[model samples]
Every structure is written in structure tokens, then in C-alpha cells.
Target: MMREILYRLKDRYHFGTPTFQRDDLCFVTVKRDELRAILTELRDVEGFTHLTLLTAVDWLEERLFQLTYLINNREANLTLGLRVMLEREDEPGATTGDTIHDLWPTAATYQRELNEMFGINFPGSPRVDEEFILEGWTDLPPYRRDFDSLAYSQQTYNDLPGRKTHDPRDHMKKALYPTYLKEAE
Candidate 1:
């Protein structure tokens, strides 16, 4: 079922082959400019009515952020992942894409979360500029792969007075194999 749809989209709009695929799932990587159009076609023509997931992954090494939209067809028992890549760095307008909230209202929340976490802009989403999970956050988006969790945690949280940090391996070796530690020393 997905194969036919992929072929049709490829013929019509020159969509590429699946980046990764399995028996019940297929992932197609599309250009940022083509995302909304392909998704609209999938929902309107392919009977993939359910937008199961919409999220972004930071590829810090590649300097790219990959946005994935997962859609499902219940009757066919199939799931399709539409992926698009965007620049990680903030350009003149920042890395933004069209809002699909109109197609799937729930996408508003997902877009908001992505905006809050990854700093990916969605120009038309009502809540995209608004805060989602994090309120009054002044730092970089917490979910970005480049976010320093240790630094943020240290800055945001106070250390408990009695808590002692220890190397887990050293503590485990001392406790579970005292004789081995003694012999090694």
C-alpha cells in the first residue's frame, strides 16, 4: 500500500525513496519546501488520517535538525514517517516551516513543543511562538542535542547538603568486590 503511494508521489512530485522501511512502516525523506504539500496529499488522498507523532531530532554534528511526521492508516495497519531536514543555525528568519495545524489541529501542540525545545519556527501555528512545557525559559531550548544538561541542572537546582557524588564503578567495585580492589591496589 505504502509502496504504491510512494511511487505515485514520486511520479507526481518527484519524492525520493524511503530513507528507511520495514514490513509495516516506511520513512520518506523530503525537502523542507515539499513537506507540507506531501503531508497534505498523504492525509487527503492516502487515507492516512492519523498523525501519530510530529517531532524533531537535532543532528548537531551535521548541523541539521530533522523533522519527522508520523502518520498512520488503521485499516491497512501501516505507518509512514515523513522527514525533512533544516539548518540548525538561526538564519535571517530562523529555520521555520509551514504550519500543518490546520490539517491536524493537534499539530499545534507538537509544533509548540518543537519550537520550545528545538527553536524551530512554525510561522502560522497559533501557539508556535507561545511557551509550551517550559515557562519563562531564557536559555537555549532544553531538548536540543547541544544543550548542556549538567550545566543547566547545576544552574537550575541547588545541591542537597548531605548528597555525596561518587564514581559508580569505584563504589560498586569497592562494595561488591573488596578483595579484587585490594589485590589491584
Candidate 2:
């Protein structure tokens, strides 16, 4: 069923090959310019009524940001994830994406969050510039692969009073298999 749909749209949109992750789920990469049109057709004609999510992945080495728009056809129990890649810029606020809030109002929230977290601008998205999670965040967007989380914690937070850090592997092993460690020793 999903393959048939992709075959029909493939000729028209020239999107990348459909990658079927499951019987009900498929992902296809679409050009940034064609995303809005493809999404419109999916919603209006293909019976994909729900916008499940809109999320971004920062590909630091590739210098790209992949935006995935997951749409669902509740009646058919099918999900289609459309991926669009945008060039990642060195300067913050340089990478931009089209706002799909007009298609799905919930998309505005996702776009705002992406703008705040990944430094991906979604122009014309409602409150895209406003802080969605981080307030007064002056450093690099926290979600970007380049962001140094440990460095940020070290710089921004002081050590808690009488707090001791433990190695995660040892802590997890001790918590889950206390007797196993004693037996191994």
C-alpha cells in the first residue's frame, strides 16, 4: 500500500527513494522547494490527516540539518516521514526552513522549538524568534552536535555541596547486578 502511494507520487515529485522502515512506516527525502507542495497533497489527497511531528537532526560533519515531517493517516494506520535537508551555516540564525504552520497549526510549536534548539530558522512561523525552551540562551543552540554539554555544565554550574560523581558504567552495573560484581572479583 505504501509502495503504491510512493510510486504514484514519485513520478510527479521526483523525490528520493522511499525507505520502508516498517510495514506501516516509510520515509522519503524531498527537496526543500517541493516539501510544501508534497505535504499539501499528502494531507488533501492522500488522506494523511495528522501531522505527527516535525523535528530536525543536526548533521555537523555533513554541514546539513535534516528536517523530518512525520504525517499520519489514522484511518489507514500508516505513517509517512518526509525529510528535507537544509544547509547548515556557521553563523547562528543563518540556516532557514519554510514554515509549515499554515498547513498544520501544531507545526508552529515544533518550528519554534527547532529555532531555539537547533538554530534552524523557520521564517513566518508564529513566535519562531521567541524562546521555546531556553531562556536567555547566549551560547550555541544546545541541541546542535557541536554544542559541548559538559563544558557548558562546567562553565555555568558550580559543584553541589558535598556531591560526588560516579562513573556511569560502574554505577549502573552496581545498581543492576550488585552480586555479579562480587562474583567477578
Candidate 3:
């Protein structure tokens, strides 16, 4: 069953590689532009009706963000992973492909999360550009690979009162030295 879908995708689209991870799971890497058409075909024709998950991966070294759409064909008990890559910088750019919100309204939430967390835009998704989890966030997207979380936290949050900045290992060794000496004596 998975092989049939693989062959169908190969015949119709320019997919990179079709990998069967298991008896019921397959993955295919595709270009960003072809994402919508492929997803539409998968949903409408391939019996993959459930958009189980949508997420992003930061390929910091390659300066690319890979968006993964996991869809499930409930009838076949099979899952297909569709992946597309885009430039990581979100500088008022367009969506890589058509938003799948029409097929799965739940996609809006995932798209919104990716928009806020990784700064990936989903052009046709309603409220995708709007804030999803964060409120009044003025810094870089927190989930981006290049984001400096420690610096952001230090600048945004106040330090706890009487909290000393010391290495725990060193502090522990110092505190145990006298006890060791007493034991030896």
C-alpha cells in the first residue's frame, strides 16, 4: 500500500527520495513550491485525510528550515511525511506553499505556532501571522536555532534575590572539603 503511494508520487511529482521507514510509514522530501499540490493530492486522492502533525526543523548550517507535514491515511493505518525546505530568515516573505488550512482547519494552529516559534510564514492561513503563544514578544523568534535564549532571559527577567552565581560543582567540592578532613582525622 505504501509502495503504491510512493510510485504515485514519483510518477506525478519531483520528489527527492521516497523512504519507507516501516510497514506503514513513509517519508518523501519535496521542493517548497510543490508542497501544496502534493499535499492536496495526498489528502484528496491518496486517502491521507488526517493532518496528524506539522512542524519545522532548523538546519542552521545549511541556512534552511525544513517544514514537515505528517498526514495519516486512517483506512490503511499508514502515515506519510512530506518535507519541504525554505530560507530560515522570515523577513516579510511569502508562504513556501499554499496553506493547508482549507483541508484541515487544525493546521492553522500548527502554522500559527511555527509562525510564532520559528518565524515561518503561512500566507493563506488565517491568524497565522498573528501571535499564537507569546504576548508582546519583541525579540527574535525564540525557537530559531540562532536565538540566544540565555541572553534573552537574563535581559528580560530579574534575578532572584540573594541568588549567587557560582558553579555548583565547585561549591559542592568546597562545602565537602571540611567534612572529608574531619572524617580523615
Candidate 4:
């Protein structure tokens, strides 16, 4: 069934080869320009009505960001993941994606979070420029591979009073097998 749908749409849209991960799940890379139209057709014609998720993956090495839109057909128990690749830009707000909030209202929330976390802007998305999770965050987006989390933590936070750190292995050995080390020695 999935193959038939792909075959029908292959001529109309320029998409990459379909990769079937499972019997009910498939993934395909779709061009950025055709994403909105393809999504509309899938929802209206292919029965992929539910937008399960909209997420982004930062591929820093490749200098690209992969945006995946997973849609589901509840009646057919089929899931199709459409992936769109966007060039990763160093400057915040440079890398942008088309807004699909009109197709699925829930997409606005995901786009907002992506903009805040991954620095992938979705122009015209509702409140996308506003903070979603991070408040007053002027530093690099936390989810980006280039973001230095350790440096940020060290600079932003101070050690708590009387805070003691322990090695997990040693602590576990002492707690669970106190005599095992002595016997081995």
C-alpha cells in the first residue's frame, strides 16, 4: 500500500528513494520546496492525517540540519516520515524553514521549540521568535552540536554549598559488594 502511494506521487514530486524501516514505517527525503504540497496531499489523499511529530537533528559534521515530519494514518496503522535538509548556518536566525502551522496547528509549537533549541527559524510561525523553553538565553542554542554545554554550565552556575561528587563505579562497589574487592586482592 505504501509502495503504491509512493509510486503515484513519484512523478509529481521530486523526492529521494523511499526507505522502509519496518512493515508499517517508511522514511523519504523530500525537497524543501515541495514539502508543503506533499504534506497537504498526504493528509488529504494518502490518509496520513495525524502529525505525530516535527523534530530536527543537527548534523554539525555535514553542516546540515535534518527536519523530520512524522505523519501517521491511524486507520491504516502506517507511518511516513518526510525528511527535509537545510543548510546549517552559524549565525542564529539564518537557517530558516517554511512554516507548516497552517497544515497542522500543532506544528507551530514544534517549530517554536526548534527555533529556540536548534536555532532553525521558521518564519511566520506563531511566536517563533519568542522563547519557548530557554528564558533570556543569549548564548548558542543548546541542542546544536557546536554549543559548549560544559563551558556554559561552568560559567553560568556555581557549585552548590557542600556539594560532593562521587565516582559511580566505586560508590556502587562499596555499597553493593563491600567485601568483593578485599577478597579479590
Candidate 5:
């Protein structure tokens, strides 16, 4: 019965049904626009009251990121994945995110983090322009694979100002410390 309701949105929405599940509650994937509708149905009709988690995965090599919403059916107390596959674009201006904050109040913070860390824009989400992580970042997002965390560290950070870049292992060598050669002695 619930599946039939969601099937109606098939043509109107773009989402993927996860192949794996362990319960009676069907896991149907729905688009961001349809997500509002589907989540409304779950809360008002099917009784999915808990939002377990919101997460994003970087597919930098593939030029995309996978966003996942873990929803639990309160009536049946079953968990299912609502996944959205977003293709990353070279043009940051073209990369826009969806807002699901209305469905879950807690989602606002998660959306903000995603925005700052990934440089994706979530339309209609409040305070997304505010920074929660990566203070004062001026370049491309640091989380993306192409961003180069090591290079950013080199450019933005200095190794204790003047401390020699010595390998700790060198200190343990017999030539450097006779006490370190106790085993060989």
C-alpha cells in the first residue's frame, strides 16, 4: 500500500531504491523535491519519526558526492536508506544543494557543515553562509580530493616556525645516540 503511493512519484522524482533491507518497510529512493513529500508521508502516514543520520561521501575521482538519509519507520521501528547521488561539477556555481531542513530541525547544522566543507550551496537552508568548520578558507573546499590537504597545510601552515624537520626515527639511530644502540651493544 505504501509502496504504491511512492510508486506514483516514480516519473516525477529521481531516487534509487536500495537493494538491501531486512524488514517489511519498503525503501524507496526519492528526489529532493519528492523527499519533502515522501518524508511527510512517512511522518504523517507510515510513521517514520526518527532521523538516524545524515552523511555525505566524496567521490572526487568520479566527480560526484553521495548524500544519504537514514530514516527509521517508527510504526514498524525499521531503518532504511534514502540516498541521493549528486554529480560534482568543476564550476562551483553550478553545484547547488537541496534543503531538507523543514523535515528535520537537526538537519540545518548538517547542511551547513556540508556547505563549508564541500563548498556546495543548499538553497533555502538558513545560515548556510555561516561557517562551522574550516575557518577562513579562501580556496576550493578542503574535503574534495582535488583540494590537496597536504598542499594546503604547506601553504597555510608552518612547522612550528623554526623547528628542524627531523625524522623521529633518526634520533633512535646508533650514530645519533649511543644509548639507542644498547640492543646491538
Candidate 6:
């Protein structure tokens, strides 16, 4: 039953590609416009009513964000992974983002999280601007593949106020024996 829908997704949407990478999982890709329909059918028709998780992947050089929504229908013991991409263009951004809050109320939280973490706004998913996970962030979306976490850690986050830090590897001998100015093998 659900397999037909999966195939229709490929035939219906242009960018609705599927990654048959592994037998256990298949990700169905769809456009922003088609997301609502695809997700609705997956839930109402196929019984995939549970939204498992929502996350975004950053393809830095391509300047695209991949948003993934996982649905698990325990009754059928099946999972459907829906993915969509948002590209940053040179022109002005549109406020109409694909939202599934109408179909799955729980989707609101995921949408909100994506808005804050990836800077991918959900146009009309009530309280879209609400923040939950990260607070006091004034920089680029940290979860995007482009946002270098290590660099941010080095720059924005400092370990201590002004501690003279030593390399743990170099201090290994000292760490091994507090007094063991002992033997070296």
C-alpha cells in the first residue's frame, strides 16, 4: 500500500528523488510545494502518524539545507523519511515555507527548532519565531553544515577566564605521576 505512494512521490515531484542506499531505509525527496501533500498522505493514508525526528543537513558549498522528517507507523511497523531542500538565493527570500503543522500538530516543535537551529524559517507554523533549544545566539545557524563548530568553540567559547592552558599530550608525564619526575621508558 505504502510502496505505491513511495513510487508516486518519485513520479509526481521533480526533485522527489529517493536514496535506496540501504535496504532498511529509503528517503523520499520532495519539493517545498509537494511536502504538504506528501506528508499528509503518508500520515492519513499509510498510518505513519508518528513524527520521529526532524533535522537539517548543511551542504555548505552548495548553499542548500536538507530538512528531514521521519515518520514511524508502529501499527504497520514502517518508517517513512521525507526530505526537502532549501537553497539560499541571491534574490529576496520568500516567507512561504512548506509547513505541516496542520497535518501533524507535533510538527510545530520540529519546525520551530529548525527555524532557530538552521535559520530555515517555517512561514505559517504558529509561533514560528518561538525559541526552544539554543538561546542568546546572534550569529549564523550553528547546526548548518557550514557553521564550523570547532571554530566557534575556539572563538566564542573560552574554557576559563584566563587560565594558562598546556597541551594534555605534553603534560601526560606530569599527569601520570604528580611527583614522578620518575623514569622515562
Clashes per candidate, residues 3 or more apart or on different chains:
0, 0, 0, 0, 0, 1
Summarize candidate 4's per-residue lDDT along 1-185 as a digit string, tens digits: 88888999999999898999997999999999999999999999999999999999999999999999999999999999999999999987899999999999999999999999999999999999987799999999999999999899999999999999899998999899979988988
Ranking by lDDT: 4, 2, 1, 3, 6, 5
Model 1 alpha-carbon drift over 4 Å, by segment: 19-21, 90-93, 168-185
lDDT of 5 by residue, 1-185 (tens): 44554466566567576444554445555566666776776667666677877777778788887777787776665666777768788755356767888888888888888888777778888898887887876888776667887787898887796777756686657467786588677
lDDT of 5: 0.72
- Model 2 residue 133 distance off true place after TM-score fit, in angstroms: 1.6
Candidate 6, residue 179: CA error in Å? 23
Give candidate 1's whole-model lDDT.
0.84
Query: Per-residue lDDT tens digits of candidate 2, residues 1-185?
Result: 88888887887896887889999999999999989999999999989989999999999999999999999999999999999999999777899999999999999999999998999998899999998789889999989999999999999999999999999998999999999999999
**Overall lDDT per candidate, in order of appearance:** 0.84, 0.93, 0.83, 0.95, 0.72, 0.72
Ranking by TM-score: 2, 4, 1, 3, 6, 5
Lowest summed-lDDT stretch of 10 residues in model 1? 89-98
Better of 2 and 3 by TM-score: 2
Count of backbone collisions in candidate 5: 0
- Candidate 5 ranges with C-alpha deviation above 4 Å: 1-17, 21-29, 160-185
TM-score preference between candidates 3 and 4, better one: 4
TM-score list, all predictions: 0.85, 0.95, 0.83, 0.89, 0.70, 0.72
Off by over 4 Å in 2: none
Best by lDDT: 4
Q: Write the per-residue lDDT of candidate 1 for residues 1-185, one digit (tens) a residue.
A: 77887888886575556765687798878887777788888888888899999998889899888888999988788899988888888432387867899999999999888888888888989867876788898888877887899998998999999999999998998899999889998
Candidate maximizing TM-score: 2
- lDDT of candidate 3 over 69-164, digit per residue (tens): 999999999999988888766453333535889889999999889888877787879987676699888777788888899999898899999988
Q: How does candidate 3 score on lDDT?
A: 0.83
